[model samples]
Target: MSKKLIDSGNNAAAMAVQLAEAEVIAAYPITPQTPLTEKLSEVIAAGKMDAEYVAVESEHSALAVCIGAASAGSRAFTATSSNGLLYMSEQLHWAAGSRLPLVMCVVNRGIGAPWSVWNDHQDAMSQRDAGWIQIFAKDHQEIVDMTLKAFRLAELVHIPVMVNYDGYYLSHTYMPFELPEAKAVQEFLPPYDYAHTLDPEKPESLNTVTLPYARLDINGVKRPGYMDIRHNLHQEMRLAMEVWEEIDADYAQRFGRGGAPILDPYCCDDADFVVVAMGSIANQFHVVVDRLREEEGLKVGVLALQIYRPFPTAKIAEALQNAKGVMVYEKGLSYGNQGALYADLKSALYPYPNRPQLHNFIVGLGGRDIPTEDLFQTLKTACLNGDRNSPEQADTPQWIGLQL
Candidate 1:
């Protein structure tokens, strides 16, 4: 039987990690993410969990340790935020390129220069091209469910997975969520069995230097070159979209929780305007959508993205093809360019003949408060006066909650 309890998101993640039976956990403390690792340590100390907790010196060494553990066919895990994630940049590429099945929780935070520890997506967004699968959670319930699904997804595709949630917003806030039985979770997720384990008896080089062209090995068997290997990784990531859908369907059947694997749509059918976002901000829009429909009589809805890395281009286009307008609210941007999701949405709908007019709004950087009134007003204006023919105006991103 499942138990419902009120707890912080960090504790929810820690509980999920224990339930998943992760063998090795190597982590360093960083704001908002520190409590999660600390909770795991306490659980292990109290004899509630049987696992190896390796305390590392820096974020770089944290990921390096996970890499080493995962290579030896162990289910490895880790967590970090902001600069800590940036410090593990080199290891991030190494883990993905080597095809190690590792799962990590990234409590999203803003990058430092001005030095503020707050909620934002800039840290995870900056690492979008690192070849790791990324999933964002909107609440504490998802923080637990997604973390469990992440481990299975990573092992299935042999790629690292990053489960992202906003710092202090979902991380520090307490909410009630169901924690599933350990027996059910164990049945849902089997033991870790990697195909290629680093065995001393059968010595072989892993992730060695590759030539520009294919070469014949000692047994006269053909081997792929550097470019070919990278292309294969890209193909596997694309296939992972369907793989995740299957895993989510099976999980829902067993635990009665997860059906929508790719995107979660709220009152979107027969709506004229749609709001697109990720993480906790998407949940906030549910309130805005209700207000717009009840008070303003606008047919507005929301589409929350669950998977970010694989892009889900075809599914995204199918969902928004008939809408009149789409407003994308994001917490991170591409510096001089517009919001990353906005750019990707435009690309997704480019092929369709009757595409929706798209607009981008950047909000809640460095833990700035995004009032529901601001969201309602901005979306209200877009529905009333959004330009359908002006492509240039739609391309520019407008900043919300900015003080000058």
Candidate 2:
């Protein structure tokens, strides 16, 4: 039987990495993610986990070390936050471009200039085009589950996976979860078996710039001008979508775990109005949905985000089949537009027959607490007005729970 214990999200992530059977862990300490590294080290020191914890001097070297290990055909794990992730930015491209399967946890935080440590998606969004597959967790359980499941998906598809959760929100939040048996996990996740790995006898080169031909090559065919590495990365990422779905299916079958399962749908099946959000800020929307139904009988649903980089807008459209209105309760604003995920969502609904009024409700910036009641009132007001120009109108992002 699995044991239930109260632990922080970072601890849960460390446990997931342990269950994933990572052969090597290369990491640098960063706030909101330091607890995870500390736990990994404790387990390593106690001989509880049979993995190597690489003490890198910086985030770049941390990921560089993970790349070396993964390229050597070993399962690897790592964690970073904010500037730490930015430091390892170049290697992030290299890991994915080389088709090395590695799993890393990103404790989502704001990028530095003023150097404030708070939860935000800006850090990850800046690297949105990075060849890595980014997956977000709704809560503590999903945080742990996704972290372990990420390795399975990454290794199977030869892609790097970013198991992302809120900085202090999920990273520091405490919750009870059943620990999966190590042996059971071993049975589910096979050892690393992939191509282009560094070997003694079967030595091979990966991600090398070969003179000029490599610059202008289209699938090995020399084309015109400019090195289109980004284009090639895009193509590979498109292919990865299919690969990711397959992995998720197999993982579900082997592990027998489901939440909203892959994606959480509150009342999208029959409702006309919908609210979408990700991470812990998303849960507040659920209570609001329930109250809307029980008190006013308003037909509003909540769609919690599980994966971000993939941007499940098609699924959202399908889920919102008869929906007449939509409100995107975005926590982290994308500077100018205010609403970060709104544009991608709009693009997804562009071809839909009944394109409902979508409101980009920005809330909980700078680690501000979002109360359920406030979100309920905000949704009610936004939906009533059918705020068509919400992306442009409204006070930039819909601020909630603020005194000023």
Best model number under TM-score = 1
What are the per-residue Cα lDDT tens digits for candidate 1 across 257-375? 99878899998997899999999999999999999999999999999999999898999899997799999999999988899988888899999886888899999999889999999
TM-score of each: 0.99, 0.91
At residue 117, candidate 1 shows an lDDT of: 93
lDDT of 2 by residue, 1-404 (tens): 55677999999999999888899999999997999999999999899999999989999999999999998888999999888999999999889877788999998887778786888777787776678888888777787778877887787767798988898888998988767778878877879887777888997666665454334344676642224655665666666666666766766676666534345778777787888777777776778888888887788888887777666667767776688877888766667765667767777888878777777776766566777778888888877776555444743556677688
Question: Clash pairs of candidate 2?
Answer: 362-398
Instruction: Tell me model 1's lDDT, rounded to 2 decimals.
Output: 0.93
